[model samples]
Target: MKWAIAMVDGILNVLKPSGMTSHDVIGYLRRVLQTKKIGHSGTLDPDAAGVLPVFIGAATRLLEYSGEETKSYRVELRFGVKTDTADDSGNVIETSVVFRPEQEKLVAVLKKFTGPMMQIPPMYSAVRHEGKKLYQLARAGITIERESRPITIYKLDLVYQADDYLVLDIECSKGTFIRTLCEDIAESLGMCGTVSFLLRTRSGKFVLNDAKTLEEISKAPFDHILPIEGAVEHFPELMLTDKQALRISQGVVTSISGVAEGKYRLKTASGLFIGIGSANNGMVKADKVINPFTQM
Candidate 1:
């Protein structure tokens, strides 16, 4: 089998439009870039729009670490309505006469959701249950119990409020379902609610302002792609000599110093990112070493 060299090897901060699945973006880029070595750091619901970091070539390896980074969103919640999917895209399961709660009460309720909490994955989500996707089972009129998973809401602020709708700015850990959080907030306020709109403002270090729309990406230079090292800039860096870098590239364990026990971005003394390494007890071992000869 023959593989063509990729045109670029980095990340694209794409502003995914609503009504398009994350895979849809990947497919589009595949056609544009003419390569299949691409992946997204996170899944954004089709009904939501915002910053989506798409990794190309060697950058795809950084997804595991980047995907775990914190994400921020601006969400709109419509009270007095409940949906099976917990968003406007789902069928309305219940409705109530809309009533606006006091600002103080709303603030109090929002505060309670901050910090760590267990969130139930919605039936209309992509979460797998018993070897099947929850959404697939939902469309077939089947519902199954799902275990609640621990998630953290680093910050949940009521940005704006009206008679029946409210806007919230949320900063949360990975695996958090904003729809579920909205529903829980409404329940706590003695009403029902569903996500009316969701816009991710940030995913790790990538922000919406820096994201490129599909049209922009089409017209932009290929150099718009950021280096793979930028994706893992949050990690501590361990610069190695040429000999040490070569050894690490070969998946060999090497001694390292002056770094805490954790993951570090492995780079050559000249500052070329080689891959990732783990530093523990003064020893460093390759976690995922990039082929310096092949990587951009």
Candidate 2:
């Protein structure tokens, strides 16, 4: 499919696979889409699978890689044991004090995690310590004392439950680890547990339903990518005329008339997304520019 020149520049969202790192997904996209300018907004553990937002072309410029946004996951918890990694891949370290509880009891126990709390990042994680990876230390049979950071767990819903297992749909701020949450739940229940499965159900507005698998993406004839402008559709906009679109694309802050006192999503007369802009007193400036259109 032929695309407009502005649209040909990078920005894409790829659904990552379980065995691949975020960087791996970019590499695959680079080969499939034939562009070296690919990047991702977040990191997904190699064992975890689900929606991973990928950026292509100019969209790679937008990656901040900061854990500032809320993240969501659908995960499965295996009760009756805890692992060194707190997931199925690690060595068993502790066993449950009691076998799995009844369904109602499991739901009740999970409710406590639905608010703000301190989370001590796992030793087998990507977190750095003394210029080294935590996982490196963990693999070396070394454990160091670490500080717990505050994180918010907005929602933790029980999707399904077995006699000794629970499947959860979680919405939390960035940096939350499903395995850790499972471990915390087991501790709260006076038992031990680990995560057998984890999948990111969402990343910002990117959802699993809209995600494409590697196999699917690899075979697809054309790049089914959402334009860079499509990534930040949540932001507000201010519509501009042809002249204004040109000026904004050139990095010239143009006066957007008739806008007052708030942030808006910016778009051109031809419906090309310009960027997010804020206005006060009929004057507007970009809050963040995602895509600049070709106009003269």
Candidate 3:
């Protein structure tokens, strides 16, 4: 038997389809599952697709601890055109002579963007200014100065190139905007550019290969709700005795030895996931405790 969405507590690796906004996915899940506690670790644009990690019920509280600070994408950039929103979905604001950079030039430009760099979030983004989202201001024809923020590009590989389009595989730290990267890269080669297609390949340990589509999940929702522990697999682990587990559950810090100082995935001696714990100065304290009986 399938459990109701209200009773389900875990993470879901959803293969988000293009044309649906991140909010749309959550709204659809809410209607299908008949619950409102669902939330996602990150949001994807309406026209971009790929892995979107969703947390249900108590799992929503574990989002910050998910350790999903890195994101990977496969994006296609089209040169000689610029859009108001920096993507094909927006109005074309400028069109210039078509100019495709040579492979050597493109490779060198990609290298220049690798490592640490500054990126200004697009006007169509959700970055906040003066208590309003940038996109909201953009919709009202209001433009504001945006400060460039530091971002890291771990890798930028040119996958494919044609007459006027090029595909790139990017692995970057959180908060990177592919549209801005496309524009910046093209500008370096003396051309205007915009993103034509984008697909998120990975988010933390969640990958596209393991993600379930909306239809697949709708058919067997419970089968797609993964365990909460899987979301925090990147953190170290600590085993607790029954007594220690009980104490930790009550928000009591327990004294321990031989544990390093840092956050960890707390588990019972019998291998049941408890929650997240912080270890320091020979004491282990619960940061977020999962209700053992409530987990799926």
Candidate 4:
């Protein structure tokens, strides 16, 4: 059977429901859009739900840059329990008496996590170890030593608290594990804990409120797709001349001035996106040129 070709190239902010792995979402999109060139910017746990940016066609090329963007989450931590995976989905490893710390004590503990710190990745994670996924080894009951990675917590605020449950709003850098953070917080308070619920509120510029569900995406029009330019709108723009545009398309480095020494979104005089490039010392090097023709 002949498969339908997808000529569209853009990004889709999807609201992934619980019980679906990040790869599962991709598989579902492949069937719905009839395209294989699809990828997500970041991975969300199969048990967690929220904003997952889906890139289609040429937008897949933007994944590397987009993954560097910060993420925000609303997480619920349940005290008096600890799981092997640091989340409710894992096997119970330990338990303790439910103790709700005072608000001042909770605030003090959260302050220590703010800013940069070292974090050891959980065993049941996608991180690769010895040429195999950590989760793969975790399933076999094999545990290996893991090096701690540096991560930053830009903001950590207590949103709500009850007898055994505490909700927190966290804005952190990429690669952060909310489950691990919750476990650490509990440990600091002399108790055991795990992430009970997680919801990604924002990833880079994409907000959860603007995310489309699988049902909505199944019936979405082409207009629902965001252009590749939208993915890198935060970068400075560099307008190119016809001759320069041609050189960029051919992977030729053209001299440029007036722009700062940094990455920029190369575009034509008419606002047509060319690609991304870097400008420094009156020279602009072609990074990735999308359009060849000067006119649209």
TM-scores for the candidates: 0.95, 0.82, 0.93, 0.95
Q: Rank the candidates by TM-score, best first.
A: 4, 1, 3, 2
Best candidate, TM-score: 4
For each candidate, what is the lDDT? 0.88, 0.76, 0.89, 0.88
Ten contiguous residues minimizing lDDT sum, candidate 3: 287-296
181-296: candidate 4 lDDT, tens digit per residue: 99999998879999999999999999999999999989873656888887777688888888888787777878876778998888888777888888879788877766564442
- Local error of candidate 2 at residue 289 (angstroms): 4.2
Q: Write the per-residue lDDT of candidate 1 for residues 1-296, one digit (tens) a residue.
A: 34456778899999999999999999898877778899998899999999999999988888888977899999999999999999999889998778999878987888899999898898888899879999999999999899999999999988898999999999999999999999999988889999999999999889999999998888773857988887888898888888888777877788867768999888886677888889888888888876462332
Candidate 2 local Cα displacement, residue 49, angstroms:
1.6
> Across residues 166-206, which tens digit of lDDT does each residue of candidate 2 receive?
88899998888778888989888778888888898888878
- Of candidates 3 and 2, the better by lDDT: 3
How many pairs of residues collide in each model?
0, 11, 0, 0
